[model samples]
Target: MKTRTITGVFFIIVMLASLLTGHYSFGAFYLLLGLFCQFEFYGLIKKSGYQPNYVAGLINGALIYIAFAYTANTHIVQPVLFLIPVTLSAVFIQELFKKSTTPFQNIAFTILGLMFTVMPFTFFHAMAYVNGDFNFHLPLGFFVMLWSNDTGAYLTGRAFGRTKLFERHSPKKTVEGFFGGLLIAALAGYILSIYYTEIEWKQWISMAILISCFGTLGDLVESMFKRSINVKDSGGILPGHGGLLDRFDGLLIAAPIVYSYLYFMAT
Candidate 1:
C-alpha cells in the first residue's frame, strides 16, 4: 500500500508535469516509455518459443517513435498507415536468414504486438502536438479520465464487489466495479470538460465511456498475454506497477480512440 501510494503519486506528478509542459521534453518521456513497452513486448513474445532480435525490436520501436513523430513533426499519413505492413514484411524477411525456426509466427506476432501494444501511443503525441491553445490540454483530459476510472473501479470494487467481471481472465475485476468506475469517470469527465476548454460536454462524456469500456478490455488483453506467456506481471520497471505495458494497457486502448475522435474532429 505504501509502495503503491508513493509510486502512484510520483508517477502522476512526473507524467502530468511532462505532459502539461507541451514541449519536446514530453516527447522524451514518451520515447522512454514506448521503448520500455517494446522491450516488455519482446520479452512476452519470447515466451512463445521464439526469440526476437533486439535490433529488430529496436527498429520496430523506432518506427513507433517515428509514427508519433510524424504526427508531431510532419504530414506523412500514408507511411503511418503503411507501417505495420512494412514492419511485418521486414520481420518476415528477417526469418529467411534463420534456418532454425519458421518466422511466419514471429512476423505475425510482431505485427499484432505493435498494433495492440504500440500504435495507440501515437495518440499521445498527436494530442501533445495538436495546434491551438484550447487543444493543448486534450491529452491531459484523457489521462485524467483514464486514471479516475482506474482508481474509482479499484476502490469501489473493493468496497462493494459481488459479481465477477471476467473471472478467468481478470479474477479481481467485478461488474459492480465496472459500473462504479463509469459513474465516477462520468463525473470526472463532466468536471474536466468544464475546465479543459477545447472539447465539448458530449465529447467528454462519450470519451469517458469509451475509455472505461476499452480500457477494461485493454487490461483484459494484457492479462491474456501474461496468462499465455505464463508470467505474473509484464515487467517490474515501475515500483508498484508491473511494467510500462501493464500500466499503460488502459491507455493503449483509450489513446487511439481519443486520437480518432480528434482526427475526425479535425477532418
Candidate 2:
C-alpha cells in the first residue's frame, strides 16, 4: 500500500511535469511513452504465442505520431506522413519470409499493436496542439477529470456498489460507481471551466461525461486483454501501477474521442 501510494504520486508528478514543461518536452515525452506502451503491448502479445513485427510496428508508431504532431502544430501534413504506409507494408512483406505457420496471425497482431497503442497516442499527442499551437490546458483538464473519475469510482464503489457493471471483463466495477464517477468528473469539469476558459462550462462537463464513460470502457478493455492472457497486470515497470499501458489505458481510448470533440469545435 505504501509503495503504491508513493509510486502513484511520483507518476502523477512526472506526467504533470511532462505536460507543463513546454511543447518540446510534451511531444518528446508522449512520443516515448507511446512507443513504450506499444512495446509493452507487443510483449504481451508474444506471451500469448504470437509474434508481432516489433521493428516495423515501432517505426510506424514513431512515424505516425511524429506526422500527427507535426501536422497538429503547423496545420500542414508533412511528407513524413508518407512513411507510415511504407512501414506498415513492410510488416506484411517481412512476414512472408519468416516461414511461420501463422503468418497472417503475426501480421494481424503487428497491425493491431499499432491500432491499439500507437494510433490513440497519435491522437493524444495531437491534442496538445489542436488549436494550431501547443496549449496544455485541454490535455491537463483531461487528466484531471480522468483522475477524478477513477478516484470517485473507487470510493463510491467500495461504499455502495451492489450491482456489477460488467462481470465478464471487470467484476469489481459497479453501476453505482460508474454514475458516481460521472458526477465527480462533471464537478471537476465545472471547476476546470472556472479556471480554464478556453471552452464553455457545459462543454467541459460534456467532455467529462465522455472521459468518464470511455475511460471506464478503456479500463475494461485492458482488463479483458489481461484476462484473455491469464495475467494480473499489464507489466510491472511501475512498482505499484502495473505498466504504462495500465496507467494510461483510460487516456488511450478517451484521448481520441476528446480530441475529435475539441477539433470539431475549434474548426
Candidate 3:
C-alpha cells in the first residue's frame, strides 16, 4: 500500500510538472509515454507466442506521435501527416526481411498497438493546443475528472457495492460504484468549468460523464485482455498501479471520443 501511494504521488507530480512546464516538456513527456505504452503492448503480444515486428511497430509509433506533436504546437498542418503512411508502409516492407512465419499477423498487431495507444494519446495531448497555445485547462481538467471517477468508484463500491457491472471482465466492478463515480466526476467537471472558463460548465459536465462512462468501458476492455491472457497486471512499472496501461486504460478509450466531442463543439 505504501509503495502504491508513493508511486502514485510521483506519477502525479511528474505529469503535472510536465504538463504545466511548457510545450516542450509536455510533448516530450507524452511522447515518451506513448513509446512505453506501445512497447508494453508489443511485449504482451509477444508473450502470447506471436512474433510481432517490434522494431517496426516502435518506430512507426514514434513517428505518429512526433508528427502529431509537431503539428499541434506550430498550429501548422504541413505535409508531415503524409509522411506517416510512408513510415507505416515501411512496417510492411521491413517484415519481408524477418524470417518469422506469420508476417500478416505480425503486421496486424503492430498496427493495432499504434492505434490502441498512440492515436488516443495524440488526440489527448492535442487538446491543450486548440487555442494555439498550451492551455492547461483541458488536459488538467481531464485528469481531475478521470481521477475523480476512479476514486469515487472505489470508495462507493467498497461501501455499497452489490450489483456487478461487468463481472466476466472485471469481477470487482459494481453498478452502484459506476454511478457514484459519474456523479463525482460531474461535480468535478462543473468546478473545473468555472476555473478553466475555456469550456462551458454544461459541456464540462457532459465531458465528465463521457469520461466516466467510456473510461469504465476502457477499463473493462483492458480487463478482458488481461483475463484472456490469464494475467493480473500489464507490467510492474508502477508498483501499485499495475502498469502504465492499467493506469491509462481509461484515457485510451476516452481521449479519442472526447476529442471528437470537443472538435464538434468548437466547430
Model 1, which residues run further than 4 Å from truth? Answer: 72-88, 129-135, 265-267
Model 3 TM-score?
0.97
- For each candidate, what is the lDDT? 0.77, 0.90, 0.89
* Number of the top-ranking candidate, with TM-score as the measure: 2
User: In candidate 2, where is summed lDDT lowest over 10 consecutive residues?
Assistant: 124-133
Clashing pairs in 2: none
Q: Taking the tens digit of each residue's C-alpha lDDT, what string does model 1 give over 1-267?
A: 889789878988998888767566677677777777877888888877876765665677667677657656555464674675577467778778887465777767666666766567766667755653324477787888888899899999999999999999999999999999988888898999788756688878887888899888988988998898899888887788778888898988778877787667632
Q: In model 2, where do residues sit more than 4 Å from their true spots?
A: none
Clashing pairs in 3: none
Question: What digit string (tens of lDDT, one per residue) describes model 3 on residues 231-257?
Answer: 889998898888899999999999988
Q: Which ten residues in a row have the lowest lDDT in candidate 3?
A: 258-267
Query: What would the per-residue lDDT of candidate 2 be over residues 1-267, giving only the tens digit for each residue?
Result: 999999999988988999999998888988999999999999999999998999999999888888988888898979998877778899999987897888999999989888889888888888777766788998999999999999999999999999999999999999999999999999999999999888899989999999999999999999999999999988999998889899999987898999899889743
Error of 3 at 44 (Å): 0.4
